[model samples]
Target: MYLHLTGTHLRLLGSMHLFPTTSRRTPPWIAEAYDWADTLVFESDPPTILPLLSANEQGSADRLRPFLPPDAWQHLNAVWPAGGSLAPLAGLRPWAAMIVAPTLFQQVVEGVEPRLLRSALTQGKPYQYLETAEEVAASLDTIPLDAIGAALALLMTDLAEPQRTLERMHAAWLEGDLPAIHRIALESPMFNLPGIREAILDARNRAWAARLTSLLARPERTLVVVGALHLCGPNNLLDCLAHPFEPVPDDAA
Candidate 1:
């Protein structure tokens, strides 16, 4: 079964059931998928690539410094000194910086993926990754620095807001609302950048579709989880798979 952010939120909500319920919520399909799967395939990088990327990212920091506007550069340096290897804003390529900014924002707001990964471990389900960190990083690197700069500028502004965008996304995921997910995804600032849609979404979707096809040839029931955005629109993974896609059941949530 192919799951998306719903799986992430479900895993999180499932894990949290051990503690206080609080405000956590999950769609029914996520639970259904988790129960049915014999193996779990995570749409993530291999474990070993993160540390290597961190080391290499700092070396590109000086290269990116000249591209930031004077005010943006000053603000970034003030917030994150260049001397720090993992300084959030400094010493990173534009694409890497763009990726990091939203990640940090999501951290503050809380995310489903971390909790979901924890649940997978606790369940002792065998897990596999879809790509290496090097491959993922290389794809992001294909994005032009100018495009990344534009994305970063918009991101900085969005960060100042109350993050209504994230709230909408989370709500949609919890409700298994695909239309809302597609709408929000299409309207994202990232789509405004040239080649980004193709590089990050379409191309990756095609690659994943091929991988998933190979997995399907095996007899073992597998649960595939990826970002919610990759499941919508033309040439999306679901479409590329040539499967008859169905909308989430109204009662599923």
Candidate 2:
């Protein structure tokens, strides 16, 4: 799957399975797309981490305390427990930890792309990446630290709204509703920060679009899995590709 660097959509896609419930059922087009593919392509380089948290880093959680809403703060403490250090989050890069903490507080499961990678390996499907981990990190670095902090504060202060938005986005994805996905992308908080939107989405989309075109030149059937967000909006990867692949209807599966 062409994954967004953050693995957000990875979780959404990976959770989809058809048998039990639609909540996580694999969207019909995704399953159908994969069924004929012999190769898988990812959007980023291999994953790695930078030291954003460490046991010795004092006031880690304290820095965020003032920004967190009462309920969010309560959830944070519930995860880390009071009087305990922020050691559990020490291994993650600061940005990663920031992204993860809110999801954990909200009890959302993520990292579906990594699981897909493992499955591809086990099934002996060849795979390639469009960008390296270093490149992805560098793009993230372009977003000012203050912006990151502000985004985190927004996440903490109004948790419910974001969660609801995500639910809607997930539903749109499952239905293969590209227009809905595009609408959400335009409204997403990331778009509020022009620098970040350019770095993380636009630039990467352009690069991936080029790579995807090259891959399409090959004779083998390829399954391209990417973050749903990348496929939406004007100038997005989907728009950039010479041949657009439409999603099959859920009922058509």
Candidate 3:
């Protein structure tokens, strides 16, 4: 799941998280650019190419393997960077940076320690939980009218479960539930234009676009990395480009 934050807010948040840690394992580029930037942009679908060095040196798998899922590792093998060695990061130099969305946080947490979930649950009722197919089918049973008052109370308060709802929507999206995301969002009164997940994505795109627009106007060289999807569609940076860029066919390789 992507941690959506405003560009400026993201920089501030990332800085706070990194300040006390001295671990040097992950590439320095992430923290370096993140800290120095006037804006820190995040995307729902950030690019995530594997580090070739990590793959080639089989011994490093014990360390790197923990960070990626098995499926991602398989893909890494298929695209293992060769010859040029550091070709995976070519064109991206000292100042150029890339950001990957936070996808495996849940999986990593669950895999490492099942207790994390129990702890979160102990806090209170989880904001929301998805109805399984069995649960959906079971809805055929009628609800007692007595529970309706409590349900309506939840809809009116800030204490109403939001994190649970967000998780459900995220799960739905990941499972190819395009309609479910929209359905859940529309059904919940708590989520809306300025505060909903979609609104957060929209704000993130506009924030990064404005930053790039200002920087590109200068003579300085800048490389802003965002999700591949954001760069391709009608709302893409390509549309905003003054010069045209041709598409390179995948088969041409």
User: Each candidate's lDDT (Cα)?
Assistant: 0.58, 0.54, 0.31
Q: Write the per-residue lDDT of candidate 1 for residues 215-249, one digit (tens) a residue.
A: 65556566666777777677777777664434434
Give me candidate 1's TM-score against the actual structure. Answer: 0.77
Q: After superposition, how far is residue 168 of candidate 2 from its true place, in Å?
A: 1.3
Candidate with the larger TM-score of 2 and 3: 2
- Candidate 2 segments whose C-alpha is farther than 4 A from its true place: 1-22, 45-94, 110-115, 242-253
In terms of lDDT, the poorest run of 10 residues in model 2 is: 4-13
Candidate 3 lDDT, tens digit per residue, 1-253? 1222222122111111111122213233333433333332222111122232222222222233343455543444344344343444222211111111112111211210122223334653222111222222123112222222222223324322444454565455344344465567555542332232222233344444555445444332222334332333233344443333332222321
Candidate 1 regions with alpha-carbon error over 4 angstroms? 1-28, 46-49, 55-59, 81-85, 106-110, 247-253
TM-score of 3: 0.24
RMSD of 3: 23.2
RMSD of candidate 2 to true structure, Å = 6.8
lDDT of 2 by residue, 1-83 (tens): 22222211111122221121225444445555555567767665443433433312333334444554557556545565233
Which portions of model 3 miss their true places by more than 4 Å? 1-160, 176-179, 193-204, 212-253
- Arrange candidates, best TM-score first: 1, 2, 3
